[model samples]
Target: MKKTQWFDFQNFFYKPSLTSSIKPRPFTAYSFVPFSPLAMLDPTILTIGGIVLGIAIIERILERWGVIDLVDQFSKIMRFILPVTFYGALFYFFATFML
Candidate 1:
């Protein structure tokens, strides 16, 4: 046979210490940390990295086809357009759907 113990009122008021994963850590101002590929695991950063690689591949293909000037022009056009498009979509989503 098992006996049931009564819960203490003091225990009800107590809070357990949070684990590191449960609580967010504070970042230091101007703290320098060595770059690690694991730290760059954000989806947005990965997407941008993929887009840059794709652009490089396309540029190489254009050069291979004897369209060297087109490659440069395409690179210049993409360098300016990609960031604007990325940020514009980001803000549009934040404003329209998120808000």
Candidate 2:
């Protein structure tokens, strides 16, 4: 009895097929409409206006409910003081190290 190779596997793997279903399509790179920067303005205004409006609404509700009065004045004073102290420290560090 004798054994024989049925096919060349290398040629079968590398060769392109005649009945290939994949084909690249032509693409257009032009458009009829022009672009504008004004398109971005509405969304920017909407987001900023929404944040400001939300803050205003919350402040108004707090004022109406007298919640602001319930908070001690010292805590309100420290809110501004703490950030100022942090900014001063940051400025001092940057001035000493960066300059």
TM-score of every prediction relative to native: 0.41, 0.30
**Per-residue CA lDDT of candidate 1, range 11-74, in tens?**
7568564655566789777736544445446566567768777987898899999998999899
Q: Which residue runs of candidate 1 sit more than 4 Å off their true CA positions?
A: 1-37, 78-99
Give the Å error, residue 43, model 1.
1.3
- Quote the positional error of residue 38 for candidate 2 in Å: 15
- Counting clashing residue pairs in each candidate, in order, gives 0, 0
Summing lDDT over every window of 10 consecutive residues in candidate 1, give the lowest-scoring window: 90-99
Highest-scoring model, TM-score: 1
Model 1 score (lDDT): 0.72
> lDDT per prediction?
0.72, 0.59
